[model samples]
Target chain A: MKEPLLPALKMTLLTLVLFSGVYTLAVWGIAQLAPNGGEGEIITHNGKTYYENVGQQFTEDRYFWSRPSAVDYNAAGSGGSNKAASNPDYVATVQARIDSFLVHNPGVSKAEIPVDIVTASGSGLDPHISPKAAQLQVQRIARVRNLPLEKVQALVAEHTEKPLLGFLGPERVHVLKLNIALDNLK
Target chain B: MNTEILGVIAIYILIVLLALPLGKYIAKVFAGERTWLDPVFNPLERLFFKLSGIDPTLEMNWKHHLAALLGINLLWFLLAMFVLMNQGWLPWNPDGNPSMSPHLAFNTAVSFLVNCNLQHYSGETGMSYLGQVFCLMFLQFVTAGTGMAAAAAVFNAMRERSATHFGNFYNYFLKSCTRILLPVAFVAAIVLAFSGTPMTFEGKDSMITMQGDTVQVSRGPVAAFVAIKQAGTNGGGFYGVNSAHPLENPDYLTNAVENILILIIPIAMVFALGFYLNRRKLAWMIFGVMTLGFLLLSLPSIYSEMQPSPIANQLGIDGSAGNMEGKETRLGAAASAFWGISTTATSNGSVNSMHDSHTPLSGAMQLIDMMINSLYGGVGVGFLNFYIFIILAVFISGLMVGRTPEFLGKKVEAREMKIALIIALLHPFIILVGTALSAFIFYHNPEIGWLNNPGNHGFSEMLYEYTSAAANNGSGFEGLGDNTPWWNISTGFVLLLGRYLPIIGPVAIAGILANKKYIPESAGTLKTDTGTFGLMVFAVIFLVAALAFFPALALGPLAEYFNH
Candidate 1:
């Protein structure tokens, strides 16, 4: 009985070691194979910035708009601005974002700037943009990439997530991944 | 409004009538009867226990049991968090999704473990097949069983007199999962599979489209987990979009069946309580109040939609489809319309339609249901809601008669009332405070605008997000940018306190009540089973919700609805 128990215990220990070993190796392989997209610096006009890997790059060509981040680098408090629409600070920020956006995308009208591009997201770190927001950027992106207007529009159209089963929420586009795909496009 | 009311009434009657008999069948299954219809799955249950070396007959006091339950859950939560954080490094990387960051991992784990299935990440794209199965699918079983276990403890509290023992927690937990939740889940999964929800290990579909373009459609072992997820009122969807995915919901019959399963057990707990207390009428009375509250709340929305939208009316589509904006065409008017109400009614926020696209009145109704904290709630937790109201009813009646309050023979004094009020009020407090905090303190900055929805409506979205989180109902009216630490940690924290605090308070109430002897039923005992009492409880719920959040809601969703 003692001999049998000893064998069973050894077998169990061996299986545990082997299972963990396999798991770690598989994870390493997947990580190696993960997306190798472009990286960039998060450069604000104020000349304050930091280096980022692929995840934080906000390229204009990519129709995908990531979730908003409310990280105030100065205050160092990571939070949603949570400012109600009536707040002066909130209104000022939106105006500034819209103003900057208009300056960058020359020849685009004020109405052409999607509110999503100007307004603060609740989390301040959203990675997806509404379909409306993505569509608004279509023309500007087409011109920047020298892609046909229809082709860039088509890309935005394809990436949109229609309401769950066509009935759940508004259509959405993942901005980060979409931008990455845009950069990769010929 | 009237049309919506009629539609809501019709839907509630249908859901309730359907859920009634199903609840009886569930009660029988839980009593350990081997049904001819249900296949024997106890072999799997026993196998799990054997592997874990947990004794089925182990006796434990309530505290020990609660600790064990909490301890096991803590381990599972950490494991899930770790797995989600390391997903890029994990197996079955069909989409090559990255691991969620610390905040998101914490949010997802807590959401499932607490039975609040609010997702910060999209399901189809964010998670791998292995992550979907191991972390999410399994938690459906555990979290749901946790609910039943909590209910069982409460039931023991009500049943016993001057006894500290609240049954065997391990036994109750096993009975809930093995005897009740699993069998129902197994059958539901089979039905879902039969209805076309896919059950497979295949990667996202790589087939060529009719347009001659190669497009990948995400696919997984969805049918198996979905059956229990809804039926147990666990509410987590296999895909990020939840029941909206064709493979997860498939068709009308599956949709209707899943909706009914999500509601039946919770509604039936009224009967379960009746049987346990040996008073079927009492069960019906509680059921009546809940049904009435649900119907009344849903009425405004249903009717609002039936009237033509100026835009839709000109398009020559039926306005009766009632806000078809974000709803599935297959589900259409009746199903999507009903699901919006039912999902909220049971605290299962997996929608078949876009709630944001709902008509103003209808949208407000959905928000109101969250404000009510889903008392006509999920499977076992519904009983907790009923239990809470029962205490309230007793307290009120006791006051009217100028006697000390008594519930099911146990005295309901100041201590009990205070505890009950705190338990009852705590969820609303969280909703109001969290929503206010999210709206007033954290305005969306670039670091947080994932969904990129703008303006006052955007603020409403964030407010609604936290409300759902704090109330532990995982539905959202406005799309949330949840990837940031603010939303993730805040919402994760909301889920935790919202779930555990109310639960712990109720359990403590049960223990306190157990120590008191049950007095014999006498003439002075309020006849709580009457429809009059039902109306009173409904009034109380409405009054409290209305009073607590009227100002905030008016400023947020209501303002947006009017402006939009």
Candidate 2:
């Protein structure tokens, strides 16, 4: 007589049901531990002001603007402009971004503008800018804070992470933490 | 290449030792001989069969066995998919990783169950403790066992006189997993744990940074899985960093040992074929040819990487240590480069170093291995690919000499030739077609941010990544922006197709051959157990690769090599 297929079918079904039940519980639990959301304030150039997220919408009297996140859906979505560094489109976008920032902070020269300030990130949704880029904005930030450029540069230094494993990836700066340190500087 | 040399020697020794005991155990299990351990598990085995409605006493032919194999695999397919999709809600996830996106889960499920293990998700960050156990670790044994069962079927086909039956798949699968895979995994895991790879619920979150800041140290149930991951040649890393992670890898001694362990079963199975065939010399010839071919192709890249680049020195980036980019200092250049070539060459895609960051010559060698689809491929599968080539070679020679082709008393015919050709060309087709579509269709797509680099070399790197993924060789150059859905789904499609098609091709060929009347061996029969035949087999492999990949590779990695 042919063997019944029902028993094998039952085992397969049981394994699936048990596996699915445990997996869902794990993800829901981790979400609970994460901070409610990132909180911070806005920096102004000229009379206009902008902040990173919706919660941080403000016309702050003192602060420095980090790199613009392309995650701003109305502005740019979750990607870089994708133009090669040498491409005319990339160069043009950088120029346009520089022109907009210069309009806000008029006294800042073309040379004083950081590359991160003008260039889009790989994700374009990068929450942080390069340290070289951060240092360029240090003078402007200091002048606005009525403090020394060295102190502002130190804050950038504090937030920078050297390469992981001393070699795995590029060195990085966490923009959120640096900006938070700026508030703590007072 | 001292590490690779050590690794190769280690594999040779381990394979020789393990094959006899393992093969004998397999033979006994299939023969229904009682062992000391069998009595203890006899009840469990009976219960499992009773529960599955499979009658242990029923004798079946190859067709019925293949059906059972397919059915069980289907069950695994569904189980893996369900586990991956819902990993977010799984238990023991202290860090709270989310469910894999639908497409990624599908890709991963197919990948692991097929023994490809092409992970889009990071084990430490993406999967919880339980998900790792139920999904990845479990699949390791199942997939490896599947490969062993297939090999045993092929062995049975060769051994049986007139009967058309290959063997029972359920019995083979169960015996392979319980008798072979589990024991080896247990021993290797114990050794690896002793070597300091962690095996606990507690995550290795200890932050140790050279620059005196916090770094997220990735750890998981690595020691538990690393054994089978290597032994089965199913090369998924416990963490995204792969074998480069200090905790996952431990130290130099463990690195060498693990690398050797990975190649041991696959290599020894060459000799195991000899044991099964009762022709030890023929297996040696296969082993010799593969080892020689592997070394000849691998050595140049190894030597090239050892030389420090002048440009690197000028930039003050230390190449003195020999191509240290994308490698952990703990493993060093020689060890990392060795692992890179050996793993990919054997169809184990675990990387100690990033292939993308390697010099152009090194990268080309790796691409070449994939071009041949690395015959010495996955564990039991590699020898099978070699055997297919050997049969094809003999068939072609037979036609030339006006004699019927026979290898080990088995006739090579039209049906077998067609299947062999299909299996041989399967990888190159996926690779060439995938590379062309990605490079041509999506080459200038705005979403392809990672391929934004200038010239054909960058395009080749992207091409290579898809080729590797589709072929189930999961080493990435890190430059490919494969995190997107377009790549995840498309590459996953190629992976699924590449894995199953070649396997299905062989099984179908075996089925056809099973029913065929065996032509008696005569003086005119072309013998396969010779160096000349091995060379001919190599040539067949080379010819297939040349016809399929030469043009695409020239356009991609080759162009990049010359351009730089």
Instruction: Please write out the lDDT profile of model 2 over residues B1-564, one tens digit for every residue.
Output: 243345434544565576556655555655567766786568766766676666656655666756666677777888788878887886677667788888888878877877877776667667776677778767777777777777767766766365677667766666666666665666666656655565545553433221223333344556666777787778887766566554456455667667776666676666667766577677777877787777776777767666653223323322344554344434545556667677777677877666665666777778777666644677666766666677778887777788777765667777788888878777777777777777776656746575644666567667777667755777666556666676777778887777666666666666666666766667766767788877887787788765677787777667766755
TM-score of 2: 0.74
Listed in order, each prediction's TM-score against the native is 0.72, 0.74
Model 2: runs farther than 4 Å from truth? A1-186, B1-44, B203-215, B310-318, B452-454
Highest TM-score model number:
2
